[model samples]
Target: MDSPHGAAVKAEDFGLKGPRGWAFRGVGIDAAPGSLIAVEGPSGSGRTCLLLALTGRMKPTAGHAEVGGHQLPKKMSAVRRIAALGPVSGVTDLDQALTVAEQLREGALLQRHYGAPVRAMLRPRAERRAAAEARIASALEAAGLDLAALPKGERTSVRDLERLESVRLSVAIALLGSPGLLALDDLDLKLSDTERAEAWALLRSVAARGITVLAVCSEAPADALVLRTGPVDPDAPDAPQDAPDAPVEAAEPAGAEGDTKNDTTNDDTNDDTKGADDALAEAGRA
Candidate 1:
């Protein structure tokens, strides 16, 4: 991987509504390509939904956004092609059963099959195989994952690896596509202070390589661009303060398409599950 090109990300008045209520609204952000961006918020603040929507995995009800010059929602499919997900918990989980090598090999195969350029695919079988191998190696290097560091080297099972290793593996897998944007969740989960520092360093290195990185974290890094998320307050001076009872939504899929059939502004139903559920539901539509 000679450093995949990154995508510029921009959003304005971006918002989403679920059956329960608005996940987030009036959101604004601007980041250059190859920038390291941190999405900061509490558990149910719609951090995950914003990640999904920007990557073309979810839809927004109000406002608009662009990733890599492609408008969101309308160009979601295109964004999906340029964006790859990493460690999104419920959305993208590693198979605990697979060995490290197996996981990397599987990712390589998927990228070769679905994301390969026509010219590359036209190469001889052996050349193609070598190319995939090279790609896997490059991704592993870029992700700072060294197989020899594992107890059993390439044969180490995912379940046996530390949380940080798992994140590295997921990131490597996402890099197989050499995507313009890489989105990850829970960047600081289950890590000590030292580990968290190392994790941020890894992300910085990735961004330096020209891949825009969107990471979700409870604590925003001091150096990276930060995007904050929180429960939307309808009473905020800037919000529809007239809506006295608009409730903030929690983070969980309540059902498919949170009240897509209804106006999300009627979204003040004080339900949290609906937005997450709606995000999940709309994600499938992508």
Candidate 2:
């Protein structure tokens, strides 16, 4: 189904400052609905900050942006409600203790309560539940997650899921609310060459479905509209070096973090459908 509120993003010399200095500066982006845009840069180059700022999660110091028709740094709240982020450090990380099914169900419930319409709130319990299930089912299908094929099936805990599976689950959760725009961090973080290719294919498929996608990656695909960021320049006169108490930008390192696993391709069957089905059942139980 096509999105009722899909909106393009346009930024003109957009910039933001953090305690350490400018997280990102002089950035520009113009992406249409259903397009794929990549924010490419090294670690600590303020890519994440830029993602947050564009999505209305952070305020910018200079320049301006309009997301989904709302001017950013001003109508940030409106943009935030329409743009969803996943794998964002403090925003959408998975809980290691929860099973895959449990997480999906919880995400759906949260979306129903927080993102659903007033009519949905007043609907009969059964009708509301059916609607939620339909949403989860559609989202899982769209994300291409096969819950059954997971190592432990639907009962598989997040800690036990492989990196790719974890990524799929996070994407599924983000899609639960059907936001017009989706933003993801670390698109190729720990994947091997083959995995990275598969991940890119998946994102491409997403964009083809009419929802705009913004991805943060060390290296963006050839076809994506790319925006590059770099570390703050202290040599600039407006740099925060003179400030006695400027804080540090404690952002994560630029490339593939946390997973010390090898970058070589793994030929593990990409069967995520089974796990996705189980997750639906689990969500229903919740």
Candidate 3:
């Protein structure tokens, strides 16, 4: 729960639509500070859309919502400042080519550049670097992740990370922002029953520390507040797990982030990865 920091979420008639049809409609919810909200629904059920809408990454075409008492749609930019995205595909996906250390370093640089206070940003390069390291250490501890456990430790590539490890890494990266609300997509995608339980437990612990969590999954644990966008139709044909929303409004990158209104594609993503790689290499030399 939030006392000093955290966001409460409330919505009334929340909905969004694209050119093709309605993404989601007529949804309402009220979650206290530090609540674990599960956006549970089958694939193609607009779960991801709802998740983005709540986090101020995507605009809602209808009704109103609030985060930490800051209203949505109208107060989207303010909402974005306190809400951080984790593991949202086409939004915050990890580059398979980048190692764990590189990812952390790049995110730290961006967090300091764009999200840190003016005084913090004015620090000398060495001091800034040390602060980043401390932030990474604190985030990793909160995420229950240890680099020493990996085969190559910090050098492990994103492609080589286990499903749960990826989740933890994503959570850590977002936590680097010191957000009041953390939102993640595809929370239990490829995990076994045991791993699924562990994921929920980690989220619960994070919530215990007073940061609200919003997770998207096909199934939600009993402890979370379930917000269903639509019912699962087992009879219908299956949809691919990671299909992007139809004409999805482009989302901001974890680095160089400003607003999520710009359009981006695969080619744009490659450029970002190359830029991060170059920056990281330069940082390593210094």
Number of clashing residue pairs, candidate 3: 0
Tens digit of per-residue lDDT, candidate 1, span 1-286: 6557899999988876655666678879899999999999887778877787677666666778999998966766677778888888766678899999998898887777677666877899999888888988999999999999999999999999999999999999988888899999889999999999999999999999999999999998899999998767855543332232222221211111222221122232223645564444433332
- lDDT of the structure predicted as candidate 1: 0.76
Name the top lDDT candidate.
1
Clash count for candidate 1 is 6
> Candidate 3 residues 73-124, lDDT tens each?
7877677778888887656778789999999998887787777668877789
lDDT of 1 at 255: 12
* Alpha-carbon shift of residue 179 in model 3 (angstroms): 0.7
Which stretches of candidate 2 lie above 4 Å from their native place? 1-5, 237-286
- Best model per TM-score: 1
The number of clashing residue pairs in each candidate reads 6, 15, 0
Residue lDDT tens for model 2, 1-286: 2243456999987766533455666788888898899999876566766776677655666778998898976776677677777676544678889998899888887777666667768999999888877877787888888887887888999999877777778878888877778888888999999989988888888888788889999999999999997755655545232222211111111111121111111110112223222222322222
Worst 10 residues of 1 by lDDT: 250-259
